[model samples]
Target: MVEALTTTIQTASLILAGWCLVSTFRDRPMLVPHLVAVGVLWLLVIAQAVVSAVLMSGGEGPAQTLMFVSYLVFIVLIPPACAVWGFVERSRWGPAVIAFACLILPVMLVRLEQIWNPAGV
Candidate 1:
């Protein structure tokens, strides 16, 4: 669990959330550019997940290994799932759903970080 990568992911997700929220307020559907941004974000998450998985395989994993792996899987899945939902809906609510997902992503990443490196460890 790299702190820098975690911070970068959190920052990017928050920025995306704000952008999606703005689009939602403007009554815009999920456009190609928005989807591209989501795709980029998803790639970043995938990279992080891959790195974490490698580290875990190397025997450098979190204390609660099962929980951390589950969170990792969930985190990797969220963006594309919501992106598809947004693309399918074709309305302002589409971006709203993305915005909501983006907002949740950062919080989940933070929790993942905590699980990866507990306070006393």
Candidate 2:
């Protein structure tokens, strides 16, 4: 179960992304979708950070350690920063910004998987 949290993080990110997509199509308030998607993204990213810290402390490889730490920094900052920007914009593009973050997360997670196990690569 060394890489189990990666799966959890991926699932949560996908769910938030799906919610953002659905809300975008339904024409919901920009903030609603933004908050919902960003909220979940934030939670999962934080969890990932914690998990990464634990794994690194447990003596994972240098590449895996560094990758998770980098993703932690990105994941922690992006969503909240997007939330603030989205709030200020007050337009459809608000949620669109969140959707963009969702796009970034999957790539990061896949990289995270690689980080957890470069031997698999």
Candidate 3:
């Protein structure tokens, strides 16, 4: 967990997700940029995972690899989940689901950071 990246990127994502939610409520299905923004958010997440894994994997410390994999699993799922749910619904609520998930990113990132650096935090 990259604390700075998590805080900054996730907060930015929250704003974008808020926009997506607002657009969902006020506009058509295709008008929202929720999927695109979520994709970008995942890019950051993947990067964070990769960096953490590489650092932890090389060291002699007791790094829990499964935790990183778990974060990746959920991080990877988020974009597609949002896309499918949002697309299938074909309604403002589609973006609403995405918006809700976007709002969750920061919290999840924070948790991930805590997992990585539990003692200090």
Q: Give the TM-score of candidate 3.
A: 0.81
- The segments of candidate 3 whose C-alpha lies over 4 angstroms from its true place after superposition are 30-32, 60-65
TM-scores of the candidates are: 0.96, 0.78, 0.81
The RMSD (Cα, Å) of candidate 2 is: 2.5
Clashing pairs in 1: none
The regions of model 1 sitting more than 4 angstroms off are none
- Model 2 residue 112 CA deviation (Å) reads 1.8
Using lDDT, give the best candidate's number: 1
lDDT of 2 by residue, 26-106 (tens): 776466645766777688777777766776778755465555677668867877887777667665666666667777777
lDDT (0-100) at residue 2 of candidate 3? 55
What's the residue-level lDDT of 66 in candidate 2?
A: 57
Cα lDDT tens digits for candidate 3, 1-121:
5568777778877887878767776965734456677677778877776777677777722255577568757865776677778778887677787787788777777766666666767
Sorted by TM-score (best first), the order is: 1, 3, 2
Error of 1 at 84 (Å): 0.3
A best-first ranking of the candidates according to their lDDT comes to: 1, 3, 2
Prediction 1 global C-alpha lDDT = 0.92
Candidate 1 structure quality by residue, lDDT tens digits, 1-121? 8778888888989999999999999999999998999999999999999999999999998989999999999999999999999999998999998899999999998899889889733
- What lDDT is reached at residue 73 by model 2? 84
